[model samples]
Target: MQLDPALPALNQTVLISGPGPFVLLGVPGLVALHAWLSVPVFLLYMAALAGNALLLGRAAADKALRAPMYQLLGLLVATDLVLATSTVPKALAVLWSLSGEISFEACLAQLFVAHVAFIAESSALLAMAVDHYVAILPASALQGTPDRYSVVGIVAVAAVTHGACVMATPVALLQRLPYCGQQALPHTYCEHMGVARLACGDMRPNIWYGLATTLLSPVLT
Candidate 1:
């Protein structure tokens, strides 16, 4: 493809593209069925949200469920709520209205929240496992069991670590690359590497970082 001679910057070999909106193509090969698909997807989203909300409410109301294990379950429920809320509204909009344009900033925010919530949920599950292990052990080994403060601290650390991974190198690399005007995303959500792949420049760093985080988050928890 020849560059437009009228624009000198366009002729440059390295052109840094500015941040722009992206078009999310929800569920490729299913465009023809969006009308039928959206109804069920929306219903599932609502049901999941309601179920999680009820869990949180019960945890908050009952004094007997205030144990650390129950607290971790509550955290998991909350994380699920956040994860769904982060992506479903935008996805449903794309499905129902056929409008999938998301601003670069909004897309990044969505990616961050979705990833952090997933990581947090995993961490909660790990914490629950540890709690169960401590409970099952004879009283002698239980002395070393972590307290509620420690559990809360661990969850906080997981959130911070995952948040840092998403906000640090991948996003910076995304902003530095040039895009060849390819903004269509293949999936319903704006995953970091998914958007990064649309860039015209080298995306290896973003890809590697994304893979590293995907493997490390669960292990670290």
Candidate 2:
């Protein structure tokens, strides 16, 4: 799609298409309350990003928090901030922008970051499972919910244990894909393996890893 500068470039118009059905039905209600609602959305989003970022910051501040697992969970939460902030607004824009198109390089960038967040969340969930067994198993084998406070205490602990291992593999694999298909993605959300599925070359590794992660998530939990 190389263009010659010899001729005038095509002029394009961009508009907001908004959303369909559910959105159409919902947005007007949202807009009516937009002033109030927007404040909450913004504040809540900032809080999530801020809180997670703080955990990461605290992890760096004290040597005691430098344990391998805490460090890993801190990394995961730090990344969650990046995902919540960097990707969500652009995604909303992509849905609204009339062009509804993204550059291939941009798409790949989104794929990498978005998948990392997903993996971190998955790893976090798994860590929850490990904590679940330890914290839920009562001292007398008949204790109630109060006995599970230890699991709640160790949420960060478990997240890091699994996150370290999970983060390592994907960080390597994501940067290596060569995109050779049509530049368009059918859906707006940037999904790593789905995009990889459209790749012209074999994606056996991606498919295998995806299945393995899915199975391991539930099994390990």
Task: Go through the candidates in order and give the clash count of each.
Answer: 0, 0
Candidate 2 at residue 91, lDDT? Answer: 44
Predicted candidate 1 versus true structure: per-residue lDDT over 20-131, tens digit per residue: 5789988899988887899998999999988998988998999898887788788888889999999999899888866799988898888878877877777678777877
What is the TM-score (0 to 1) of candidate 1?
Answer: 0.85
Q: Encode model 2's per-residue lDDT on 1-221: one tens digit a residue.
A: 44455654332111212111111111332434534544555667778977887888888899898654574466467657766865665544443442445554565566566665665666665654554565456578645644334443465545445545654564345446544433444454556564665455567777778678768865765
After aligning candidate 1 to the native by TM-score, how far in Å is the CA of 49 from where it should be? 1.0
Clashes of 1: 0
> Where does candidate 2 stray beyond 4 Å?
1-80, 98-105, 122-178
Lowest lDDT 10-residue stretch of candidate 1: 10-19
RMSD of 2: 10.3
Residue pairs with colliding backbones in model 2 are none
